[model samples]
Target chain A: MPVISYIDAVTQALQEEMQRDEKVFVLGEDVGVRGGVFRATDGLYKEFGAERVIDTPLTESAIAGVAIGASVYGMRPVAEMQFADFIMPAYNQIVSEAAKMRYRSNNTWYCPLVIRAPYGGGVHGALYHSQSVEKLFAGVPGLKIVMPSTPYDVKGLLKSAIRDEDPVLFLEHKRCYRLIKGEVPTEDYTVPIGEAEVKREGDDVTVISYGLTLHFALKAAEELEKEGISVHVLDLRTIIPLDKEAILEATVKTGKVLIVHEDNLTGGFGGEVSALISENAFFELDAPIRRLAGPDVPAMPYSPPLEKEFMLNPEKVKTAIRELAEF
Target chain B: MGSEESVMETSRHEALGLSDDQVLEMYRTMLLARKIDERMWLLNRAGKIPFVISCQGQEATQVGAAFALDREKDWLCPYYRDLGMMLVFGQTAKDQMLSAFARAEEPNSAGRQMPGHYGDKRFRVISGSSPVTTQLLHAVGVALAGKMEKKDFVSLTSFGEGSSNQGDFHEGLNFAGVHNLPVIFMCENNKYAISVPIEKQLAGGSVAARGQGYGMPGISVDGNDPLEVYEAVRDAAARARKGEGPTLIEATAYRLVPHSSDDDDRTYREMGEVEEARKKDSLVQFKKYLEDVGILSTESGAELEREIGHIVDEATEYAEQAPYPDPSETYTHVYAE
Candidate 1:
């Protein structure tokens, strides 16, 4: 076992997949020679050369569209979106083109593409940089959205995404890239998509989250353990094709539930999770299903105090968890 | 009328390296597309089909461009009006009929997408959607894949003149030109993007002239002349296969019918203008060229028409009787099984 940063785990997955499958290649704005803006695709250009590791123009639509075309042509392409907020320019290509490729083509054609984007707020990245865009695409049926909270999950889920038959939006929480480090197996392994993991098992309360907030929830659960509050933390690694069975089980384990995320409260992914729990496990709830998320402001602000107010931290998660547990 | 005139007419196809039978086949495909499109319009009028986007006036360009490609190796990302292109690339009248009827057995979308959203893996035709010019980028991707793998294949994508103004048109073409991918961007400038005429659709008033900014040779051909389109596409394909990069082709023609079954051309344009455009119909012009070159006679042309009529009739009957998709399978294929 080797301990690796979340960003290194991403690089490992890409490198191993490219080595394992010759058809697998990478393309994006700075993915090639510059090794990606975050260095997530670092050294891929030198290893795979210019053809395989393509440095594309500044157009996001072309980045998405070209990856789709290559995937349809039997090539596995991993396209980087630089930042998740910038993915709007390529929204049509992803939502309309990549997402609907298989369904619209009557299963005759499918796009096996992985669109990687670094997302989340904090570290002072304001309006243009920080965004939780997964909710915008969660409603789209054909797309699979994966947001991992650890190095191990990132490695396995990304490998699964790249090899998956359909389009997968692999969202990396930029805040978690360097902050989260965990032991990952040096050998080949994969964390399956659409499955939720109970990171901390308890019976008093259930905290479900993904990405950076998932880490905060885990830390909150650990600190609350000293106070005789048993909190169950579930990491929803894959949002789309959500692990409904796991969600139900987590809710049943503890009747009180608190869904946490960094996205806005209204129309956030927490709404869907809350709806699923309420619809299926209505009687299992000991308290009203609560959701703690960013306020419904347009986006994250640039000022430090305002940014902190907008983002979810361990302190916020601890308070939300204690409130749910006591209720 | 004279022997010298006959020789000149025959030489025109020969100079393009087209044999008599091949030229005749091109004519037949163009006519078949026209007949199919005409039947679809009738079906729409009679309420047998839900919609109709015609290839009536642009068959020459579609068929000609398709004929110039290596049918076995090349890929196509054709628009809704590329009926002739689909036929040349291996889509049958039965397939088109199934698509038009939105039957469960249709190869395009199995009743999911609207008719004319062409796609068939067997023939290497990439799937398309209603948003125009997006297929251009998909075609470029296929070409990029081919180039990356060192494969011998070119991708051709077609769109309407109105689609040329789309941001995707700029993005797709700029990417293709930058990468020098083996793709052909053919703009079927039928002079309208759903009733907005060419003047309003194009800022420069020319689609081909925009190719210069993308570093590709752009050419405009008469959409009514199948031979001219064939020659231009053939040269473009040669350049693509040689790694010289993409070519922008503008084949100017008229939209013989309304944009779709839902549109009313009478609201936007005069009936007399449409009637005038019909006189220069590619089907009528190509038939005359074939007859003048001694490849077709009155009897042969009539026989071909009768054969196409029988095929369309059979296709329509079969599609009408084909079953709709079962409700139980509505959620299938969203992801791989």
Candidate 2:
């Protein structure tokens, strides 16, 4: 095992997949010559040349459409969105064409493509670059959404997403790219999708989170453990087809639930998770369900104070967990 | 003497080397499309079919462009009004009826898509969605694959005059132009996109002229003249095979009927206007041309119509009696095995 940054894991996954399958290619703005805006695709162009490592124009719809067309023709295309917020122009391609390709064609077709987009708040991305787009695409059928919080998980999930038979939206948290570093195994492996991983085990309450907020839940659990208030932190690696069994098992064991996420409260993935938990594990509840998430604001502002106020942290998670456990 | 002018004057189809039988076959496909559509509208009014999208006045453009391509090699991404194109591209009369009836045997979509949403792997006709211009990009992708695999084929995608205003259209063409892919973007400008006329739909004038911005040759052809459309598409396909970029073709026609059975045309256009356009219907004009050129006589025309009537009748009977899909199959295709 070697310690690597979150961004390196994504690059490693892309390299490994392209090497493993000759049909796989990469395309996005600055993905070739400039090595991507975040350098997540660094040096792929030099190794694969122009055909495999394509640097596309700034049109997101065209980029998405081209990838879809290629994927439909038996080519595995890994498209980059530059920024998650910029995916709106390509929304039609993803929702109407890519997501519905397999269904509309009635099993005669498949859009087995991967779309990697760096998303999250913090680092002053402000409004446009800081959006978390999982909520927008989670409702779509024939599509998969994955958000990894650590380097090891990101590497495994990216590799898995590329090989999946359906269109996968691999949302990489921008803040985690450099900040989150962990040991990634040198040997090839993939973390299965639709499975939740428990980062910490506890008996008092089950604290569910994912992406950046999963770290907060873990930190809160660690701090609570010192005071004998045990907390179980579960990271939902995939949003769609969510790990229902894991969620039910955790809720059954803890009897108290608290959900944490960076996205706004309304219509977030957490809302769906909470709904699933309540419906499946209603009888095991010890307290009313609580959520520690971003406020229902439009977006994070550039101002540090306003952003800080809007962001969730370990303190907030710890407080929510303590209150849920006590109740 | 004008050097460019030839002493011999002939119909455009004759000049394009269309044999009498082939032209008649094209005419037959167009007539079949119109007849089937007429039947669908009747079925809708009689509360038999759920919807009706007629190919009424634009049959010539559909048949002509489809005839220009190599059906076995080339790919087609047709719009909702391409009944004639689907027929020419190997989709049988029964196959269409199965779709119109939305029966389980519908190969285009397996009873999933609407009637005119064409797709068939056997004939290389790529699948399409309800969205107006996404198929344009899909066609480009087909051409891209053709280029990548070094196949001697092109992809033709058709849309209405109104859909040319979509971002997908622009993006699709821009991509095709940049890649120099073997693609022919045929814009079937049937005057009205629902209710908006061509004048209101495009402020920049001709859809063909916009091809210049994307670094491709743009052409405007008479969609009512099957010969003219065939020549335009034939030349464009040649250019694509020669490693030249895509060509934008604006085939002008008229939507003689309302947008769909659900629409009423009176609020948007006067009946007199529609009647005037109907006078230029290719169905009537092409038949008269064939008669004048001595290619088809009154007896032959009647004979062809009777043959088409029989085919449409048998297909209608088969489709109406076809089985509907089971409820359990609805969840089947959402994911792969």
B193-224 per-residue lDDT for model 1 (tens digits): 88799988888899999999999998999998
lDDT of 1 by residue, A133-237 (tens): 988999999999999999999999999999999999999999998999999999999999999999999999999999999989988888999999999999999
Reference-based TM-score of each model = 0.98, 0.97
Task: Tell me the lDDT of candidate 1.
Answer: 0.93
TM-score of chain B of each: 0.97, 0.96
Best lDDT among the predictions, by candidate number: 1
Candidate 2 achieves a global lDDT of 0.89
What would the per-residue lDDT of candidate 2 be over residues A209-272, giving only the tens digit for each residue?
Answer: 8999999898889999988899988889888758989988888879999988888899888889
Q: Per model, state how many residue pairs clash.
A: 0, 0
The digit string of per-residue lDDT tens for model 2 on B142-225 reads 677677767879889999999999999999999898889899999999999899998899978899999999999999999998
Candidate 2 local lDDT, residue B4: 40
Name the TM-score of candidate 2: 0.97
**Whole-model Cα lDDT of every candidate shown, in order:** 0.93, 0.89
Where does candidate 1 chain A have its weakest 10-residue lDDT segment?
Answer: A318-327
* Model 1's DockQ score: 0.88
